[model samples]
Target: MEITDLTPAERRVWEAFPRGDGVDFREHPEDSSVDGAGWGPERTVRAEVLRALLLGAGRAEEGRVAGLKIKGARIVGSLDLRYAVVDHAIRLRDCWFERKPLMYGAQLKALVLGYSTLPGLTAATVRVDVVLRLSCCRITGPVRLQGAKLSALFLQGAVIGPTAGEESDEPPLQLNHVEVGTDIIANDLTVHGQLRLNGATVGGQVSLDRARLLAPGGIALHAETLTVGTDLRAHRMEAHGMVNLTGSRIPGQLNFAYAVFVNPDGVALRASSCAIGEMWLRNCPPVQGLVNLRRSQFDLLHVPAATWPEKIRIDGLSYRTLAPHLPAQERLPALEREESGYLPYAYEQLAGAYRTAGDEAAARTVQLAKLRRHRRTLPRHGRAWGLLQDVTVGYGFRPLRAAGWLLALLLVGSVAYGLHAPRPLKAGEAPDFNAVFYTIDLMLPIIGFGQESAYAPAGWYQWLSYLLIVTGWVLATTTAAGVSRSLQRQ
Candidate 1:
């Protein structure tokens, strides 16, 4: 606290604190700094000096227009200001800190540590008026900002947590229950541990485009129950662990295009119960685990055919429209990836989408696919009946097949009876033998032409007549049953 005890470098910072003048020691730190140790006296500033300056030690009233701005210096010792209220901006860019700053429950104007190297940050429940910018910082420990309220949080290109393979129990970066006013942008950010944002309420968008979240065999991003006012963009992000967004509410687009996931936990992305707007999984690489999107609702889904993961739990995913508008055949394959087993509503949802697009044929195709899947779960007799309907009339989806069967049967009956004509009944009085009309009447089951009634066939010919009648009735019954079932489904 004595002026005579202060070093030459510390004395300069002490004299300039009141005016808030920025102190740039030199073009670079005096010497090659090593964790606030190897730096010469020129660039090494004691944390007590900064704390004294921030606490208004030697402040002057005349030139009190600025905050504290120190660049390229190595701050040694703890800048401990726990629960203190300070109305000044702290900009320590391109600096090295020996010990992490402790600002728990402190109220500050701003804290910008751009391009600095710090052990970690712990500012739980802190209130900042302006912003918290840690852009391009290399933090070696967990950065906890839980329950903090700030205007904006910009972590662009920052690298947090330990180096790869040094896994820790604590999450590397956590902003859980934090409230941001504008946006929380973290593009190109890399975290070696789980990045948690559970219960975060963001007024604007939260962009994490091209961020590398690496926490192997564990959760990479745990942002459940989040409330985002706008978009939550994570375009092209490569996550090594499970990204769980179980119950988020993002009214804007939730984009994950061109992203790659490699989680060994059997599940990659879990976004169930999310009421999101447009969601994009387009152009992304094949995921290694199941993407659980159960009970999620989206206005417009932008999952192209190529981006669908091989396994999914899409039991209750409802989307109004699909991007690229592929036909049902091309899109139905995605529904097959649902590992939660047969779900009729999922098929109906797809069919409804096609119907809304005015593609009834495609809709029918989806319905048929659904029935085929249903067939696998049916009993042996039911499956046999389903197979018959499928082969004969495509479960009433292809009525032309029924017509073709009728035509082929009529021709076979006509050929058999013509080659072995039945003996005439009431000789000289019976109607003339018309092979086509007689075969048609026999197959018709109800309508009777005079030829079939007036003639009598003995032995094998009589058996053939009975066969034609039974075949006609079976075809008609199966066609009617299949058509009725199809209509019932619709």
Candidate 2:
């Protein structure tokens, strides 16, 4: 479009473009002469004229619109670029917009809106070949990017909040189902509402380091079903509500080290069913609520035992390895910190995981730890029974304890019968009894050697006979149970 044919607002934008030189606006003078005509802050443009200028520039060579920069201008209306394909990069710095720009289904090379102020942005299904930057900008309403595709999204140091006079609670930034070729860096961002990225697929990392999100009593970050090819780094993130990443798949690590979560009565972090390569929550700020990791799988876990929240739900959660090699004393206590006393199956699962990783010593430690915690839950008198099971049979893991008791009992009985021999009851009964044979009869409950009927016991011997009978029954029952348990485990 020729300058003469353009509208007054369009003419101003046309005049703002540099002639042939590829100098960026950042290097240009604040009050540089435009098209031999001097322009100032008073040069406001309508959104329609800006759109037309972009369309005209798209038809030109790639660098023809390289320095097509706009600054200190107030856009009068919504800049609707729906379905428009622009080839060159667009940069709008220090600009103000009356309403949010609508870029639904639009295609662009790159978009930069640094130090700009807008009510919001709606770029649903829009595609950007290069970076989509909103650095140091102020967004007042929801920045919706549902189904959009971009190389990277940079919102570093941006301030996002609710629109003026709006009190309804909703997400301030939504990237639902969006696909990014690279990272989404939002470090130092101050978000007043929830930042929802549900179903988004990121080829690279999603870094929200040092970001502060505020959505009290609700979800501060919701990334359910998100697929991240690399790490989700949110180190030092301060969330006022739950940070939910339920069912997400992260091929790389999920790092949340030193992050602060403040949802005292509810779930502070929920990653149920997630599959993360590794997880780092070591030295995290005190979480006031529960951190639920039910059914999640991680290759490695780095969490301090003392830093565990007041409540945690780890039912079915398994990690292939644990960092720093927490001893059973520390590990079991952490698992016991759950509000619901103790979960025996959780301990079993962890021990099984350890065994699968070729850490049998750790597995046995965990198994014994589970037994100890379980003993605490039993009644005072029942705890003694449990202790006996542990010491004698190792909670059915050591069947040889029953055999040891039986052998010891047989020895004691042999010595007692040898010390005081019994006499035959009938005159015709020839005494064919020895100390060992007589003791065997008393020790084996199901078998008989005719010793108890044929030979008569004295006062002390009679009591000893009764003691041996009771010991035989106890050992036999325990041994049977232990053997059955070992078989079942196999």
Candidate 3:
């Protein structure tokens, strides 16, 4: 590890470090042996020595490292003690890198570590400058950069591996309270590990906020107490495992808004103890997820004047899309006045789950409650009451004409009975014995005596007049009652 016994190539790498101040990394083609292949056991020491020397020279103009490579030597021995000062942003593009506890506690400027594979590299407590872009990097061991200050940290298209085993002492990627600058766009990044940002404070907008974590994958992003400035836009970020952020504080709107989670049977976003300015999980299409904002508060009153998606899938519930601005009177009326109460379906599902587990009383209570609400919210006087009345009036009251027909029939019957009178008597024939007997017999029956009528009684036409009067009143009363009830039903 001494400088006196340095080989020719090692000597050149060492000499360049001290002499290459303010050097442009792009100009030095020999700075990074990006295409360097396998290294021999004997040559690795020389190569590593040169690597350390290059790092010691510190950064050139734009924080670029010159001749940075290891060319695969099994990574049994420690390498690269000198923390390469990246004057320009460091680029590890196309480097056949193999790190084993190397760069363990190094300080450097912003890193553009991408298109490279570093298996066991550990940057435990390194303080990085603005913008740590790690696109398409395959990281195996736990990359713990706790207390690292990353301004525009992006990890787009990177593949991160998980911890070794249960007893493995590797800490999760702890960027705990690491302050980020403007945007943290990490789209299409896959982390097969426990990505923890327990208390990270991103000063600006945080945008992981599309990274995917496959399952039975271990712990996903746990930004529990992370703080954000503006929007946390994580749209369509799929995680088969859990993404627990129970106590995160988002000052602006949390826009997972439309992010779809795969397995919501697990904890999706547990913001139970978090504080959000506004929440926009409006139309997420998760098959089964739980956005447990149980005790969270939404202080941001103005949740963008845009129309929100009505329906969402939560814990096996498929909520149909609805207008967020629906008037209280307009939304499908639920018995509960509180908006939270509108989640009866979800409640029922939970209750059913409980009930299926042998909690009979609880299950019955939930089902009964739903039934009561359904009945309570039913519209008054049936659905088509008003329409039926309108149609009745539009048809010109044919009901009234039907009543007239019944009345006319009764009047005709009375007229026919009178016209078929039993007697047609001569004007002066009363002195005849036979005629007198017949007239007295008819008179007895008409006067209520128990005898057959041989002739009709006097004033029978007057009786018909009275029948007409009664029929008129009956028809009028019935028509009035039907019309009154129809109008009053409104």
TM-score of every prediction relative to native: 0.94, 0.78, 0.54
- Reference-based lDDT, each prediction: 0.87, 0.79, 0.51
In model 3, which regions exceed 4 Å deviation? 1-12, 15-47, 54-77, 80-90, 101-105, 162-172, 215-218, 299-490
Model 1: per-residue Cα lDDT over 115-150, one tens digit each: 888998989999999999999898988898999999
Pairs that clash in candidate 1: 19-63
Q: Model 2, range 359-416, lDDT digits (tens) per residue?
A: 7777777876787788998899989877877766676666677778778878888898
TM-score for candidate 2: 0.78
**lDDT ranking from best candidate downward:** 1, 2, 3
Expressed as tens digits, the lDDT of each residue in 1-490 for candidate 3 is 5667765545544455543422222223443323333544333334356345545443343554443332222222454644544443444454445554355456666566665556545565555665676677666666666666666777787777753453334433556667676666777777765677788877788776467765443456777778888777777776666677777888777776556555445555566666777666555663344345455555532222232122222332321222243322322222242324455665555344434456554444454345445444557764243333223331123365635544454446435444554333443432322332332233222232222232333475436435544544444454565466436522
Clashing pairs in 2: none
Compare the candidates by lDDT and give the number of the best one. Answer: 1
Question: Which lDDT value does model 2 have at 89?
Answer: 73
Judged by whole-model lDDT over C-alpha atoms, candidate 3 comes out at 0.51
